[model samples]
Target: MKRVPLYAAALGFIVFAGFPFYWMFITAFKQNRDLYVGAFDTRHVPWIFNDPPTLEHVRLLFGQTDFLRWVANTLLVIVAVVIITVALAVPAGYSLARLVGRWGGRLGMGIFFTYLIPPTLLFIPFSRVIALLGLQNSLGALILVYPTITVPFCTWLVMGFVRSVPWDIEEQAMIDGYSRLAVIIRIAPRLILPGILTVVVFTFTLVMQEFVYALTFISSVDRMTVSLGVPIALVRGDVYHWGSLMAAALFTSIPLAILYNLFIDRFIQGFTMGAVKG
Candidate 1:
């Protein structure tokens, strides 16, 4: 009986958090009439389907746009960025935690501060760099720039995560004649797996959702990522393709949502522990 309020609260929270996805799901399939009805029209229920659902929006999104190409571009960028962030952040973090001695914490904080600088502010400078490299209108631009955003914070996260790991195990390995590089390569990684995963997931999400750099650097339709592509494709002048917009959002977001759910435990641990420990 005492648990009833807790269950109700949990249910309420779920519904509240999930309402937008619910709206997107229905709006994606809803008929034009069902969707455009005035809010004052109480005769039609807004929450439930007012008419039979259709796949027209889905077809429009898949058939009429470069959505698949955007997906591929987004995935490629994600893969490259994740690899770069991990390769850079993990080592950088471990170095700060173990190698930098007493100043590591201060250095890690300074690095994390760089991550806090808004992407909006950095995109202008990045645009110049991309132009210099001749990567304008290219996926390569995104692959290059995203690491700048991801690496700093992820480094701090990994540094904190590494700090939380017990030093004794790593010390024992070193005492057994394993070199520092060998300890990092062989043993430290296993203990810091959660932090690395956190960096991977964070980098993936950042690359997927980012728009400023993608839009600034990529002008060609085929080169745009989903975040930049969808609105440009769907919104023509003042007319909004709400159904297709919703469909595109629903499609792109579900996989990310699923990924987060799958790793929610580790994600929370990595984020919170990293912040607190640091």
Candidate 2:
């Protein structure tokens, strides 16, 4: 039947897409003996059903490395960036939506376009600025650098959401003896919740995943973020610790996965609203 091929194709695509993650999970538990065996070797290497799996890699990662410190540094920088982005972008977005004219739209577009500039191009100058400010090897350096990407896109996204909100309701609240700021504080809350959540999730993810700035600015072991710490701890000069590396990767990804699942509905709605309006 016609539906038979469609079902087969869907199953095929899922298998193809999921195989890598499945392999990584399996390999993370695999011992060095199993890993060293050739794939073509018919020596009965029980990769799939291998029991007595080791947690040595995970243990080594947590026990030997500054992983906890790296995680703390990443969380701190991400929290700071998220707070700064929300504080600056929300009001700026409202202004562009309510006060400014066509020029405001152009300005918002321009700000968003700045984010498209590759970080590689900006790193040298940014490094010089950091050096001048004496922030070299400090977590504060990441705090300053991360906002370059977070603010612009967030402002544009919030601007679209703000524009979509009906102003009549806000005006009525203002007429009912509420000050302008109070009306915005109260009525805007319901409508902008999705947009704010979008900003927080996107900004946190971006800051967490960023590498170039972190690599360039931070060299001290104690001050590194998770993205930088993983490679440094797991990769030696010519040797690679594949097991520990995969374990660290798996651990890092789990929290983000949970967060995405928790607020997926609002996240989707926020992005949809921004896209349709913009």
Candidate 3:
């Protein structure tokens, strides 16, 4: 009897969480008229079945707008940020976890705290830097700025995962004539694979969702990232292209959803490792 309410609660939560995505999917396939009429109207709810679903919005998004270009630009920036973050964070995390030095741990914590500084506070200063470097409206600017937040948090996350790993194994490798760096390359990578995957996914997702920085830094139509492109291309002044907007949103979300599912096991393990002390 108790299980009945638990199941009911679980089902309710799932519906609450999943309804937005479902709506987006539905709206993506919906005719503009259907969306403008509003799905909440009971009168129009049945019209969803009567009206044949169309791929017109998806077709229009790709054909009319530089959506593919925007996607490519966003992907390029995300890939670069992920590479930079992983390369820098992994070593920084390991050093913070394994090395004993004055203020090592405190320094790691301090560096991570820098990420908590809101982008809103930094945008004006960043704009001045961008203008000076001539990176205004360039994808390179986004790539450079993105790592400011991704690296710090990712480094902190990886630090915890690295700390949870046993150093005795690395010490044994060192005693067998392997250098510390060699031991890390040969042994630590295997143990921390899950953490690395976690960082990759987290960094990718964060970069993909970021809007403010992309909006502020980019103005060229072709140079705009996905987050910026969608709103600019789909929404006119005081007018929203609901169908195309939904299609673009759905398209953007699909890749991330697949990535999450693919690495979900390792992602969960990474968090678990970070949370529990060995």
Candidate 4:
């Protein structure tokens, strides 16, 4: 009987958190009339599916917009960022964990602090740098610049997770004639996979949502990331393609949502343990 309240609370929380996603999902398929007809209909719940769903919006999203290119570009940026973040963060994190001694924690903190610095503050200088490199409106510029934001925080997160590994075991391996590099290479990966997975997901999601850099560096329609391309191409001044906009958003979000759900256990395990042990 006592568990009933707990169950109700959990259900309530799930609905609270998940309702927006549900609405976004259905709105993508709803016809324009079905959407607007209920706006002031106090008798109807606005988003409830009263009329039959249609794929017209989905069709329009693909037919009229460069959604395919946006997907390709977004994927390219995500892949590049994930590779850079994991490759750089793992070694840098391991170094901070084992090699840097007492100052390592402070150094890691400094790195993370850089991630906290507002993107707004640095976009001006970043734009200048991008211009100087002659990558002002290029997807390549995003691939190069995204690492600056992704690596620091992921490295710090990985440093904390690595710190959770037993030093006594590492020392025993060293005494057994295994070199430091060998021990790290063999053992670190085995134990810190959850942390690495967390970094990949985090960095991938960041690339998807990142706006300022994508917006500033990619002005050409063909070059835009999904984050920038959708809104730019979907809405014309004072005129919004709500249905197609919702469709674009839904399709783009579904894959990431599934990926996150698949590895959610590892992601949570890495974060909770890393925070406490770090």
Rate residue 238 of model 2 by lDDT.
77
The per-model lDDT (C-alpha) reads: 0.87, 0.81, 0.83, 0.83
Residue 186 CA displacement from its true place in model 4, Å: 4.1
Scanning candidate 4 in windows of ten residues, the lowest lDDT window is: 269-278
lDDT of 1: 0.87
What would the per-residue lDDT of candidate 2 be over residues 166-219, giving only the tens digit for each residue? 888888888899997887788777778878888899888888789999989998
lDDT per residue (tens digit) for residues 36-77 in model 1: 999999988989987999999899888987888889889998
Model 1: per-residue Cα lDDT at residue 36: 94
Estimated TM-score for each candidate: 0.88, 0.88, 0.87, 0.86
Model 2 TM-score is 0.88
Stretches off by above 4 angstroms in model 2 are 40-47, 261-278
- What tens digits encode model 4's per-residue C-alpha lDDT throughout 109-224? 88877887877888899999989999888888998889988898788878877877778877888899999889888876877887788889889888998998887778888888
lDDT (10s digit) by residue, model 3, range 1-278: 69999999999999998887887888889776666775577766733444778899889888987889998998899899999999999888888888756566788778878987988999999999998999998998998899998888888878877777777888888999999879888988988887888889989988998988898899888898898999875676788777788889888888988987886665554445445543
Better of 2 and 3 by TM-score: 2
